[model samples]
Target: MKRFTKFVFKALVGFLALSLGLVLLFKFVPVPVTATMVMDGNGITKNWESLSNIDRNMVRAVIAAEDGKFCSHDGFDREAIEKAIERNAQGGRIRGGSTISQQTAKNVFLWQGGGYFRKGLEAYFTVLIEQIWGKRRIMEVYLNVAETGIGTYGAEAGAQRYFNKSAASLTPTEAARMAAALPQPKERSVVNPGGWLRRHGNTIAARIGSVSRDGLDSCIYE
Candidate 1:
C-alpha cells in the first residue's frame, strides 16, 4: 500500500509539471498541431496567423454566434451548463455549454469526444489556460487550432478555402458564414449556404454588429 501510494503521488506530480510546462510554452509559441488535427483523416491544411492578422470581424462573429458572454466568463459558464443539463434531461440531441476557453483547451490539449474522464481533463486544462493564456491568447489559439472546415484548420485556411481570400480580409457576412459552419465544419456549407445554415449565418452577421457595438469582444481587443 505504501509503495503504491508513493508511486501515485510521483505520477500525479509529474503530470502536473508536464501539463504546466506545455501550457506555458504554448502561451508564446504557436501550437504546431493538436490531437484533433492529427485525428482528422481528411488531411490537414492550416496557416498560422497572429490574432492581429485575422480580421476583427471573424472574432466578433464567433463571439456572437457561439458565446455572448465570452468577455465576462472565466473559463466556464455555469448558467449555460445548467441550461444544457436541463435540456439534455428532457431527451433529444445532446447540447454543450462549452465556452470558447473550454473549447480552446480541449482543442489544444485534449482529444475530441466526451466521457467523464475526458470532460474532467477538459475542465482542468480550461482552468490552466484561463489562468496562463488570458482571454486574448485563448482567442488567438482557438482561432488557429479550431477545425474550421473539412481538412482545414484555422481562420486562414478556412477563409482561403471558402472565400478565396485571406483571413485578414474577411468581411462581416463572410466571417459569419465561417462562424456558422464552425460548429459542424464537416457538414455545414459555407460557400453556398441555404436553409438553416443560411439563416444562422445571417443571424450571426446581424449579431456581429452588436458584438462590436456592445463591446462584447473587448477582452480580445484589450
Candidate 2:
C-alpha cells in the first residue's frame, strides 16, 4: 500500500510538470494539432491566425452566441453551469456551459466528448490556461482550434471554406453564422441555415453589436 501510494504521488507530479510545460510552451507557440483533430475520421483542415488577423466581429459573434460573460469569467461560469444542470435534470439534451477558456483547454490539451474523468481533466486544464494563457490567448487558441464544420477547423479555414474569404474579412452576418454553427458544426449549416439556426445566427449578429457596445469583448482587445 505504501509503495502504491508513492507511485501515485510520482505519477501525479509527472502529470503536473508535463501539463504545465505544454501550457507554457503553447503560450507562445501556436498549437500544431489537437486530439480532436487527430481523432477526426473526416480529414481536418485548419489555418492558425493571430487574433489580430481574425476579424473582431468573429470574436464578438462567438462571445454573443456562446458565452456573454467570456471577458468577465475566470475559466468557469457557475451560473451557466447551474442552469445547464437544472435543465439536464428536467431531461432532454445535455447542455454545457463551458467558457471560451474551458473550451480552449479541452481543444488544446484534451479530447472531444464527455465523461467524469474527461470533465475533471478539462477543469484542471482550464484553470492552468486561465492562469497561464490569459483571455486573449485563450480566445485565440479557441478560435484557431475549434472544429468549425465537417473536416474544417479554425476561423480562417471556416471562412475560406464557407465564404471563400479570409477570417480577417468576415462580415457580422458571416461571423454570426459561423458562430451559430460552432456548437454543432457538422449538423448546423452556416451557408444556408434554416429555422432555428437562421434565427440564432440573426440573433447572434444583432448581439455582436451589443457585445461590442457593452465592451463584453474588452479583455480580448486589451
Candidate 1's residue-wise lDDT over 50-109, tens digit each?
999999999999999889999999899999999999999999999999999999999999
Q: How many clashing pairs per prediction, in order?
A: 0, 0
The TM-score of candidate 1 is: 0.99
**Candidate 1 runs further than 4 Å off:** none
* Per-model RMSD to reference: 0.7, 0.8
Scored by CA lDDT, what does every candidate get? 0.95, 0.94
- For 57-176, candidate 2 gives per-residue lDDT tens digits of 999999999889998988899999999999999998989988888888888999888999999999999999999889999999999999999989999999999999999999999999
Residue pairs clashing, model 2: none
Q: What global local distance difference test value does model 1 have?
A: 0.95
Report the Cα lDDT for candidate 2.
0.94
Instruction: Give me the candidate number with maximum lDDT.
Output: 1
